[model samples]
Target: MASFEASVQLNATPQEMFDFLIDTENILKISPPDTGLSFTKKPDKLYKGAILEFQIQGFGKVQEGTHEIIVFEEPTLFTEKQISGPLKSYTHEHHIVPAGENQITLIDRLEFEPPGGLLGFLITESKLLDLFDEGFYQRHQTLKKLFP
Candidate 1:
């Protein structure tokens, strides 16, 4: 299994940051070209049963996916699981906390294990891992501008 974590401070209220994140269309604007994301169903808002699809460059073909919004603690925490994707399993947890008056801290955590056993391990080391790290950095940079 591999894990990743990142946090960013947004000069917007928690609700504002949360709203921006829940917008699925934001993916198209912010996601890097390599993600190969294709919209399946857009959520009216973040909830327990929103489905999304994206093809990860290093992962195998067509990775149908869903976002199981497992945790919804209002303007604080939201979590989700990838029901189907290129990985054998994936879970992402997001946290939004008050950073100061008019500011918020966004935290993202991911835990996943790829398929193809050892071959998958090799692939991750060789390709996907670094890109995933960069993707998060890009996302944070984009969000800071939008929310600031």
Candidate 2:
């Protein structure tokens, strides 16, 4: 399995941060424009067992994926796993902790593997890490500005 973790401090309460993250619509607003991300199906509000289907334009083509919310603890933690996608397995956990009177710390932990065996491991360890690093950096920057 390959994994990456990142955290950002936001000038907002846990509830505020959680509320924003739970709204799936905000994903398109924050994702990279090149991703061409759009939701094929999404729940009005995310909850345990909710599944989200989305498409992304990448690798000279479009790819679709479905994310299922496996855990949802309001104002604290949210976890999701890819139910169907290019990946062999994918799991993401979002943790929100109170930092100050009104500040919050947001941490994202992700574990995933591609379809193939050794080649997938090499690709994930090499290329995918950089891709996710850049993506998460952009996401944190956007969250900082949005919450501030």
Candidate 3:
């Protein structure tokens, strides 16, 4: 298993930060448009057991997958597990912690294990890790711009 984590502090209230982070619409806007993500199921309110399906377009093909909310805590933490996807297993956990009265920090932790153990290690060491690093950095920048 390989782990990738990124954290960013924002000058916003925890509630405010949570609102933006939990919103799927905001995610789609900040995500690369070329990814072609479409939510199959969206909830009016966020909680445990929420399900969502996304289609990612890459290399001239669309890969479809669904994620299930495995852990949820209001205004603090939320986690989702990839139920079906290209990877063997994937889980993304989001954490929001209050820094001060009007400041908050967002933490994103992604733990994934791909198929073909040896091959997976090679892939992560080669380009996939860099790709994830860049993606998270861009996401943090986008959040900073959006929140700060």
Candidate 4:
């Protein structure tokens, strides 16, 4: 499986960061505008066992994916696993840690197996990182401004 991890310091409390993350509508704000992200299953807040179904426009086609919240610890961490998607498997963990009096650190970890079977070997970790780096950069930038 390929893995990715990234963290950012946000000038907000853990509860604040966690609250922002649990809201499904915020996805459109952080993602690249061209992605055309829209939720098929919209919830005011996420909870354990909640399923997230959405479609994203990419390469002139629409791709749909579904993720289930496997773990949920309020204002601390949560893990989402892809039950159906383009990839063979995908798991994402979001962690929130108190950094200072009013600051928090948000970390994201992802482990995924590419869409192919043995052919997945062609996709290197670095390549996967490069693919996600752009989106995450935009995401982090938006977070910084949101909490500033």
Distance (Å) between predicted and true CA of 28, model 4? 2.2
Model 4, position 112: C-alpha lDDT score: 87
| Residue range with the least summed lDDT across 10 consecutive positions in model 1 | 53-62
Candidate 2 has what TM-score? 0.93
Question: Which scores better on TM-score, 1 or 4?
Answer: 4
- Angstrom error of the Cα, residue 24, model 2: value is 1.2
- Candidate with maximal TM-score: 2
lDDT of 3 by residue, 93-115 (tens): 98999988788888989888765
What candidate 1 gets wrong by more than 4 Å, as runs, is: 54-62, 117-122
lDDT of 4 by residue, 1-148 (tens): 7888888999999998888899888767788777778888857789999999999874457879999999999989999999897678889999999999999989989998776765456655565677677777788999998898
Tell me the spans in candidate 2 whose CA falls farther than 4 Å from its real position. Answer: 117-123
Model 1, position 62, has a per-residue lDDT of 51
| Runs of candidate 3 exceeding 4 Å displacement | 117-126
| Clash count (model 1, backbone only) | 0
Error of 1 at 104 (Å): 1.2
Ranking by TM-score: 2, 4, 3, 1
Candidate 1's TM-score reads 0.83
Q: Between which residue pairs do clashes occur in model 3? A: none
* Model 2: lDDT of residue 38: 93
